[model samples]
Target: MAPPAGPGATAAPDAAMRALSSFRRRRLAMRGAAPPAWLISLATVTIALVAWIAATQAGLVKPLFLPRPGSVIGAFSNALDGRIDGAPLLDHVLASLMRVVAAFVLAALVGIPVGLATGLNPTLRAALDPFIEFYRPLPPLAYLPLVIIWFGIGETSKILLIFLACFAPVALAARAGVSAASVDQVNAARALGASRVQVVRHVVLPAALPDILVGLRIGMGVGWTTLVAAEMVAASTGIGQMVLNASNFLRTDIVVMGILLIGALAGAFEFGMRRLERRLTPWKGKV
Candidate 1:
């Protein structure tokens, strides 16, 4: 063939270079089109920190009441360095986490089965619905005195309080989930010679999983809240205890640290639950 009419005898090299350039341009455009979510989050945090620092520097707020971020960071570091009594920050965090997990597990263990039975069976629902309705509205802390009397002012009492807080929500959610199972699915399973147990396992349980997970999330949050209250009663070690101690000393830094720590921990747990829910319910549509 007579050489191409361009500078290069052939257009192949030019086409390849153009394709590569286009790809690079596209990638650059994509990168520049939107800021990463993490960057936005970091920017937000930076803005908050700057605002706080400015407020403190301007003396708009008292350091005693609202210490500078550096002070909080220093206190946190000091807590890690064994400046505080009792235990390190990690220990306190671990202790609180342990109690919350144990209580939540106990709540799930007791509540799920009760919910299934009550929800699936008319007679059981009739019998237990009244009690559930009665107690669900009542605050778990309100029964702390009775729980302590029954279980003593020890781990058992605290765990029981958390369990009570978590249990009602789980049961109610489970019951709602079970009841919400599709009638068509149940009938199809029945027609296929599946037993009631099979129907529940393959149809009801799978369908109800989303609701159950939602319940678990809500229940865990309640359990965390209850843990703090329970720990306040007679805890020797916990974030709750830390807050109580800080309050006694009027160490607002420590108080703020304790509150922040609880929020951070709760947020961590919530994140974990969300991941778990996503993993388990891959087939379910997003909420």
Candidate 2:
């Protein structure tokens, strides 16, 4: 039989076992660690671009269905020189951007307050909820004719269509965000002699900010999607208009170019909103 170990002898072994366990854990953690998100995104984009080039070169897909990247670039150059439908790319971009930005700003200005009022006052919520909910699920195209009849096929109708598209999501997000603040926090604010307005301004708004930002992001996406439909209202100049014209003429390369431009713009907006969210709601996931 082995001799009994002393207390000091066991302590050394225990220390070694702990060191071995820690080393194993660290090795496992290192092996399981994911690569940086940006690297993964880059790799994904690179692979997609390579696949697209290879597919086009291999004639697996016709140029009509998927134009070569060089053809799309040529279309882009033509757009810049006002050769594609005789309007410069800047003109189309600005028209669409102005309409989208205007509608989004208006929606945010109006929706946030209405959402707050409905969230705080049951009477207001009861009165408005049915109307909002009734129309919320309806697609913008369903009411396009009505909008044109009421407002005419002009800028007003176009902006209004996009506004209506953006409003519901922002309002609902703000309403839902109102519940994020704890009862304890509200009570604490009230107990400290904060007025109703003060409590809301300080506590409620901050708590709901994350959700509001999220809503804005969602609303912006909806606005972009609605842009094409909105610009369809007798529009002569806009990215959507350009794409529509290209489609009509079977200018698939121009169509592809316009699509890529719109996607790039929307992606930029998404990236901006994400940065803003991180800046404003640093404590978002921490809690």
Candidate 3:
């Protein structure tokens, strides 16, 4: 190459080159040796709390908008002492859980079988797909009025609303699971002298289970989301009701606490469902 650059150019380039190399090595080290998932999760929570504390201390965010963590904790303590709303916090949580479990069971009882039938029979799929597709995208709020009008402001209406919220996801998941089943497995079962029902019961159901569990997880999530809307009816005892009742009085601390409680419960449900899936479908993704 040419002779060495002037002293100024030479110095600048040498420093820049060293800096770039160090940057790249640091990046590679970090990227190649990622922390475990739990560590990452913990880091995320820590970062959020640190940010929250900073914002609260700096007064950048209004208490009305985002209550302080200490305020939320105090609200939680109050809830524990049975002063959150008209009833104890556990009563509200229990009421919401009862509604969720009842609605989920209803959806599973109906939607899973219907979904299985739709995938098993081309005719049924053709007949039901349109109806399922139409309602699947509709939000729970849109149909709550009709549900309330028909069913009155009873617990039945609330349960039905959550049930509908859960139904389409569960049904569609089961249908997808059945569709994803191996044609080879079905053919082999038939070849081995299994009857149609037996093949469906044994070959198809097992193949579709993992997906069905996934759908159940999704359905349960939707059911929880629908809870607030469902409890909009003339209701008094539910986590959703507590949130709404708190917001009516501008109790941001209570609102934030309720939101966190709901989020924690949802995460727990998701974790439990994942465990159940692993236990039941241990052969997932295997050839």
Best by TM-score: 2
Model 1 reaches what TM-score against the true structure? 0.83
Whole-model Cα lDDT of every candidate shown, in order: 0.86, 0.94, 0.93
Candidate 1, residues 1-287: lDDT per residue as tens digits? Answer: 88558766467888999999999999999989989998999999899989999999899999888888888888899888668745888888888888899999998898888888888999999999998899888887788889888889888888888888899999988898897688998999999999989998998888888888889999999987876788877787888888888888888888888888888888898999999998999977754
Please count the clashing residue pairs in each candidate, in the order shown: 0, 0, 0
For every model shown, what is its TM-score relative to the native structure? 0.83, 0.90, 0.87
Q: What is the lDDT of residue 69 in candidate 1?
A: 82
**Where is model 2 more than 4 Å wrong at Cα?**
1-28, 31-33
Candidate 2 residue 143 Cα shift, in angstroms, is: 0.8
Per-residue alpha-carbon lDDT of candidate 2 for residues 68-177, written as tens digits (9 for 90 to 100): 99899999999999998788999999999999999999999999988887888899999999999999999999999999999999899999999999999999999988
Model 2 vs. true fold: TM:
0.90
Models, CA RMSD each: 9.1, 4.3, 8.8
Misplaced by over 4 Å in model 1 are 1-41
Error of 1 at 200 (Å): 0.8
Q: Cα miss at 40, model 1 (Å)?
A: 4.6
